[model samples]
Target chain A: MAAAAHEPEVIRDKAVMRAWSRCRRAEGKAVALVPTMGFLHDGHLSLVSAAVAAAAGPVAVVVSIYVNPSQFAPTEDLATYPSDFAGDLRKLAATGAVAAVFCPPDLYVRGRAGHPAAGASGGAVSCLEDAGGHAHETWIRVEQLEKGLCGSSRPVFFRGVATVVSKLFNIVEPDIAVFGKKDYQQWRVICRMVRDLDFAIEIVGTEIVREADGLAMSSRNVHLSCEEREKALSISRSLMNARTAVLNGNNHGQQLKDEIVQTLKEAGGQVDYVEFQSLTFSLD
Target chain B: MAAAAHEPEVIRDKAVMRAWSRCRRAEGKAVALVPTMGFLHDGHLSLVSAAVAAAAGPVAVVVSIYVNPSQFAPTEDLATYPSDFAGDLRKLAATGAVAAVFCPPDLYVRGRAGHPAAGASGGAVSCLEDAGGHAHETWIRVEQLEKGLCGSSRPVFFRGVATVVSKLFNIVEPDIAVFGKKDYQQWRVICRMVRDLDFAIEIVGTEIVREADGLAMSSRNVHLSCEEREKALSISRSLMNARTAVLNGNNHGQQLKDEIVQTLKEAGGQVDYVEFQSLTFSLD
Candidate 1:
């Protein structure tokens, strides 16, 4: 209860974060970690609220704000991923839900202790380059879960996600963790990874948060031109239409996807993928 | 310390080991982990003693006994690898220097919670196959370090070692880890992995242990025939000669290797490799 009202601690280094978290854990506090690429939209904040609701018995909610470079392709928006560290902290502080904020400066740029053999270049290699690029050696993958859907279009996406999440889990050592179902496939990938790796942490998947216009909240939405933004609305709108149709006894899977695709295509949207499955995505 | 006098606890599950280690860590007790495949030898016990000697201020020493199959090549000796669980426990008990033994049944099998998408196979496939061999998608590699020495002959060796050790680090949550220099390349690979990954633990490399006959003690030594074992002694004999040559100021790298190669050749021993480098082996 004190943590909810207390001003959340701002931690920049992983070492400080670990010491803080470990101390709280020793006090029998149940910690829930919310990992985010920050630029606090309503979506990220809603995840915090979900963590709060899920928190029980001396719970401390911690949110990590990191724009992981490994997750973005060189041509993709690595340079453009939004950030406002002061703004994020202010918003998190306003919520009165977070107990601590973990904002590591260089999550991907590992230690500068260059391999003496690497000479001038050191061991600081780009993680995504050829095998010789970076010295980073560990990765976690949920094979089947990362294969379908956005996986095909963004091949390196889930590998980057899983690797970073695994590091976060190791760094934070939280008892419970929260992720958004908006990135539905990612949620499944993470859940499967946690289960397979025996991480001993509970994973909570929060529902998607949307604006009054029914568009899902995302930091990237801010960069869209007005016309492009209107067209982007079709993406979420199509999902809503399919859900309504299914609720109205339209149990035909192919027919539902066909209708949604048509609506998105009319709005000049490219439907990358559409999938429906049981919540857990159990392979058996 | 009380830990040094008490009989070492034998832990078979990952969950229990984590909780036990976490509790001690929270109490400010440092933990030193030594991971090994079972069938303990004096070399293994020496690793334990190093861990004990290095542990400071309420130390807990943990040794994980798991024969990781993923590290062995299919044609190599996975089935023939030695195991004596009871004998290993007895040896560790005799040391009175170990606090716990973590012997998991399946270090690489992962969870049986099969994914539904993999058709009939689910996630039950073996960890080492072609690209589509199994559903396990995680791996750790120390590119430059794994390239030389036995790594060239045994390509999958370092990958398997890095992965399983990473898992053990996550599971045991030790403060310090000790490795043997007898596994010279393996030691370097692990050091690079820990540094590159920012594991937040100290790695101590212990001196290589040898028998009175100058044979390096290994679990696999049990499989050698008497004549074969006698020839094996030549391997160490050449190494001791090489060391003496270097110490006696034989600075010519090529000349020393040429002489050593001829010695092993005369003894009817096929030398796998001979590497001389600065300790770090940076490939700049």
Candidate 2:
């Protein structure tokens, strides 16, 4: 069959999506979704590349552009998460992506409209406690994947990721979804979720895209100062060192972790966390 | 504006949904979705009624027909739940439903493949621990709503409802999705989920449609014995008594619960749970 046409790039609402599906059925084309938060970097591009390669037919890569508020902690840089829609679109186009950017607001808060009680407007918002009746009491909790690593530091982070990713998977309805492996825990958690929920879409974890100096490309990289950027290279370097150690028969979990932590500290990098567990076997 | 032509109901795969979106935009019509499992009843019909009433243009009620395994507990009757596609379609047609049912086994199982060792044979399994990895790892936790009523008896019930409902919402992409309040907690949880997740679609909760004798129409009602059917009337009767007590200046929480429990027992019915909580002035 001939390849499907890729004229319509941006689909905002559900109606457009339905029509898109109808046309694809006529052409026997497949869609690949690359969900992102709009600040497209090399890491995101890597996911797009993976999506393009994995799709069997004409691909429709939907990059959801919303910087989800639920995923961010109150103390985190939610308000200042970098967003470059124009730049993101140009980057996506450069990759020959037949992708639509879906960007929505952070808060779609709705109520019967009687306003808040008194002057409680400008207080420090406790995201967990203040959710009160405002947030849907329902939350997606991924057990083992969420208990360690980033979940240790940011308690609510994976819950937010699981929920948002679930929403995107539902909205985009892609044959395959590409996620960068740099957020290894997130990728694992999402994979677990997809398997648990039985979302038909195949989740492809793209290899970590790196900078010239070997630092993993992250949106948060923009937050690092010149010196911090130089120091951040240690994080990737430490992982490489750990990998080398594992290859050289250093299979002891604690030994590999200790070596990586020592290397990072030596390189002037603040160690967030460094731990090793058997890849195939359960830690417990 | 003229009403858009209703497209013939077509079951589109994940790849097709994207293409369908683009085609609809070209045709100048928005898509509205109403999601339902097969085995249609008045409860589901009520949601379709709401969807048709709220839709602006060509509406597509993508009835996802899948008996989701992740939602059922091991002890619950997952195998026995009713499913009738022909009968459901007939009902859909009566409700002016314009779209095809988006039934996919994997779509129904969205978020369920946590245990890699379990493999593909894990079909239609319950959330029992021994059922292995195909058993649900992620659950939608609803706080207060899950504290009383049916939740007490069926611990995994609302979680299953929320997860499946979420999957349906994502797959259908409705502008206005309808839900029947027969599953009152389900309706409330979904409303909260849509708001919390910033889903653009409007959630319309339809009032419960009951049998002539007042027992809520449920797919499980088919499993009830003739004698059990007569006994089930006590559930509604107990609810009515509780409502009457609250209306008669019964402000004490314990007293209201006690009265409801007593009324149910007096009517030769097993009391699952009776709970009372202060209704927020603002939520009202």
Best by TM-score: 1
lDDT computed for candidate 2:
0.65
Q: In model 2, which runs have C-alpha deviations exceeding 4 angstroms?
A: A1-31, A83-99, A107-133, A276-284, B1-127, B130-135, B142-147, B167-180, B194-213, B217-261, B273-284
**What digit string (tens of lDDT, one per residue) describes model 1 on residues A166-202?**
7788778888899999998899889877765667689
lDDT of 1 by residue, B1-284 (tens): 46456578988888899999988787778989999998999999889888877876778899999888667766687878899988998889888778899998876543334342232112222235422335555555566677778977777788778878888887898999999999999998998777666677899999888889999999999998998888888878887887897778767777767777887788787778777767224311
Poorest stretch of ten by lDDT in candidate 1 chain B: B117-126
Query: Which 10-residue window of candidate 2 chain A scores lowest in summed lDDT?
Result: A117-126
Report the poorest 10 consecutive residues by lDDT, candidate 2 chain B: B117-126
lDDT of 2 by residue, B186-269 (tens): 777778766655465788778878999989988788888898888888778777776776688655656656766776787677
Error of 2 at B82 (Å): 8.8
DockQ of each: 0.31, 0.28
In terms of docking quality, how is candidate 1 classified?
acceptable
Q: Once superposed on the true structure, which residue ranges of model 1 sit more than 4 Å away at CA?
A: A1-5, A110-137, A248-252, A278-284, B1-5, B108-135, B279-284
